[model samples]
Target: MFFLRMTAILVLFAFSCAKKKEIYYCPMHTSYTSDRPGTCPICNMDLVKKEDHSERSKDPSTLLRTEADGKMESKNGMESEIHHASPSNDRSSEFFLSSEKQQSIGIRTELVSRRSLVKKMSLYSSVAYDPELYSALLEYKQAIQSSGLLPESSSSLGIGNLQLRLRQLGLSTEQIRVWSSGQRDPSELIVGGKNGRAHIYSQVYESELSIAKPGLNIQFKTDVYPDKEFGGKIKSIDNIVDKNSRTLRLRSEVSDPGHLLKPQMFGETMIEISLPGLLTIPTSAILDTGVRKIVYVQTNPNSFRAVTVKIGKSVDTWSEVLSGLEEGQSVVSESTFLVDSEAKIRFGNNAHNH
Candidate 1:
């Protein structure tokens, strides 16, 4: 009877040793381990079963699987989820959302495309005229027309000087021809009245002087005609810069049909210039926090990921993309903030629970 009792006792002890012990850890604090399950001391979060860490460490290519708390980490200690990681550094960046939820939140997306971006610059200007220059040009035109009656040698030398002076005063060959033929008066061109066009004089800073040239379209608005927009092309750019303001003078001829745009009338001018082909997106799609510019890209159906992008000049409603995004990808254009908020709430709640 004593031998049988001893044998039963030994068998019970062996059976207990064979059963594996369950390991427990805090979901919020994965490093915190305990032999028995309980609330975490630091965060007070409930403890959960600790899965075998060895399996994850063995496969470096495998994705870090999330625990019940939605917390996931790779063997190398890097975050694996797209929504929770920094957009600039994360390689596998993506998040999941249902189609129904996306619609409820009013999320909308647009495909990225290559386009020729146009940059517009605005400048304040006023209508101007030079009475002395106009008078000199008129006299120069008469001298050239009457030079044919003088001695050939004297006419050649005298008319040449007068032509040079007229050119220096900003009279074009076409204008000289018209005035010499009595087709139009040189004074009328500078005075700008019933039958003439007004001259819009604007200043371009040193930074913008390179692009300031003739033939660029300009739209100007004056305080007198608040509802009207006057259109013209850059007719001339001065070679000299203003010593005080450090700006180059540019002139555009605008038709003054109503004679409302009088000399010294202040106005605003907009000049549009086309840029090279570049990737672009809507300005409304970007969430600018000053520190970083972020945009949500749709990776899959109802799945979105935050991406960091470098932006260049912004024109009107669109912006130039410099880097961090690919062409032909879809990005969330509307209600991006709501999507980010939802991701945080949903994932943050799960991260604390067992």
Candidate 2:
């Protein structure tokens, strides 16, 4: 009986002890549980309570201690010197230490400005005959010639009759006299008319034709203002192509609001249209890496970071900043990449805590 009672009491005591012990487990890993403080099997991290005490401590109102000047303060504003970390110069340290200093790339900058001067380029074009219009004009001339109103050959009539033929062909009296007196211009007779001759000037030059549109914008410059601009709207496109140049001559009539532009003066011309929402960046702040463009951003004092960027057309020296940048962020404009390299060197030198 004594042996049975002792065994029963020992069993009850063992059960009580087992009930008093607490179990701990990792919040992330439910499979890991332990009675003593130790790491989880899978994660190899110290097993923590399933419910986190750090989570409840996050509320500012529940904070029990405050720190000022590197010292922890009690609920009562007591002051104590904080144990400041010593400067480290460990070169073999592996983990990253986020410090106050940041690195960045240096770059150049120029503000956008407007000027009166404009760059221009010149183009040489020739006058051409418009087959359609030429055919029409020729047909009209033939109708009158075949009707006997105008003689095909002015030599068929006497001088007076020739004069009459010249008039019929749409030639003025002056033109008829010039034709009859063939000593000066023999082709004058070519424009002879029985009624009136339509004077034909052999050296007549017309503007290029706008095949795309009946009318087009004409921009040109003349010798008067070698650097000024003159622009005009297309009056009409000649329905002809120059046989010599093989290009349709287009005539653009531009208005001279400033009247600085004049006729017959040679100048450069350009065609441009509007396209919006294009990305751009400052050209001065860029570092060209044979394959890509780069810029150094001032991430923090003494820290410049190298970043790649896309570039677009330049407005003067200021380049259109494209991707890899945000507005209002500061960047090192002058030698920013060099600055970044220097920063990296400093960081590597100070990588180890000192």
Candidate 3:
């Protein structure tokens, strides 16, 4: 019994000796590790359990941390210090690059400034006309004119009412006057007349009603005339919105100089709405991560810092800056990808060192 008891004691001691030590590390600074549960010494972030080294090797985030010849190395194999500023810490992100290196990499910078943000909304529309309606109206006017003498009972009143009805059917006051004077040509007053212009009818979403106004310039293009852009201006906006589509009708007049814009021919219309006074930057300067947008700003001749920014409307070449940037500051525009890659490498190295 004594021998068996001694054997059990020896086995328990060996098992305790074989138990692995619990390791902890900062998630942001993966290299900063501790034997006990605590916060990271470098970033002050909560230290989490360090999984098996074999499991960590499978993680892509850990790929930036490499081991070479008894030293920790960055993915780029270069040793550099990268300062990462957390908003909570109130520190600014900064790094260094030589002027010669900047030129070699084709880095370019532009000053952020306030500018008007013009948003162009586009929609499809077509030229349309109703021939039967115009024909019936013309016949009614002719019949009334042919009855040369008025009836004795309320004759003048009857004529006045008929003339008013004609005006309501889309006849201009001048057109009605000319018809009364015995100058009547149905084709002259109808759509697709000698005026050489076409009416374009488009629908604007209910949400866009605020921006839809008369006299706004519209440029349209058709499949038939792919190389040409026809110009027009908004003539009217419908008072009612379609219940089914929740859209409002918009009418415009376009000069059909070549008569290529035919009735029922579909085309795309573009209208620009002016937005006054917003900070903007070139679209090329922004680097979008999945969660945040980054821009590199030049603090000195050879130093650049990555700044987080909030962006708004984007026009052709510029994007509205909603926050995280100020006017008169210069940001790197060209070769931004290279700078970002270098910044990541430096950040990894610095974190590893810490």
Candidate 4:
């Protein structure tokens, strides 16, 4: 009798211990496991396994969280009555996509002729001269020399070592003769003369001497005649670059006279150095993410997928697809962002789907 009582007591104690321990269930993931847990292993829901007949069914519709108290309640209502509240509703709420839809805004661009253009950088520039005072000095020399104001010995004063002395004394041939000729008004000569003779300097810019350097080719378009396209190849580039601006003054000759593009016009340039069979893609097909570039490839009419890509140089409307893509593959061009969103949600990212 004593042994029987002891065994019974031991069994009762084990049963009581098991009953006191709690279990857990995940709210979002119901298939995960927890042992002696307070919350679910996957979803953090309080796990309650009841022995009652009402609590044993796997029908998700029978399980509900009552609004009055935060606890799971089970009941059997008409199947049609709770059809609106399925697990799909939970997923829909989690991936709220109403705001993720693409806007109807349009991006505007001027289309250029389809040609093989090499990408290049172009900048707006101004026209300038090196020296401006030479014209004034030439006039001063001619006027004084013609006025015949100097002595006969001075008449032959030009074209020798003495001309250098005359120049140095601020006495141009014109200024000395304007005084000797007893001219009523010699202010122009006087202005040229100053106190003594001096040298004058000037600069000119008739034809382009900088942009036409040998072997360099440039294609340009201007905003003034935005529709017109111009092309040129470099004849020469100045060996001395501008110290202030650091620009290599180039001289280029346009083979086609139709490209009489004016100076100081805003333009874009391209230099095409062809490499054989470089992989490229239409720029329209790319989708830009802040962190990584992406694109959507068409798997089927109703299915698409998002793929991250590495990109290289871009020219006009095409981009160099470095990786994550292959040649001859089809992609969503006009609606890539919209399709990528849908693909992410379908593939279980829970991201917003457009």
User: Is candidate 1 or 3 superior in lDDT?
Assistant: 1
Worst 10 residues of 3 by lDDT: 81-90
- State candidate 1's TM-score: 0.46
For candidate 2, report its TM-score. Answer: 0.32
Say what the RMSD of model 1 is: 12.6
Question: TM-scores for all candidates?
Answer: 0.46, 0.32, 0.45, 0.33
For candidate 2, lDDT tens digit of each residue in 145-231? 554655646523333454454444334555334434433333212322122211111111333121223234545544556675555
The numbered model that scores best in TM-score is: 1
Report lDDT (Cα) of residue 292, candidate 2.
69
List, in order, the clash count of every candidate structure: 1, 63, 0, 31
Give per-model CA RMSD. Answer: 12.6, 21.2, 13.0, 20.1
> Candidate 2 clash total?
63
Candidate ordering by lDDT (highest first)? 1, 3, 4, 2
For candidate 4, the per-residue lDDT at 238 reads 40
lDDT of model number 1: 0.72
> Could you give candidate 4's per-residue lDDT for residues 1-354 as a string of tens digits?
999999999999999987744433332343454555466555445553322223333556767655343235666632212111123223232221121222231211122112344544453422111122234345445645664875656556442444444344333455435434545233422233223221111111213232223566656555665676556554333444456655554433343343233323344554455434557667887878677787665433223445678876666778777787776666666655445433443333533232
Give the alpha carbon lDDT tens digit for every residue of 184-220 in model 3.
4445324453456667778888777767788899987
User: What is the Cα-based lDDT of residue 15 in candidate 2?
Assistant: 93
In order, the Cα lDDT scores of the candidates are: 0.72, 0.43, 0.70, 0.45
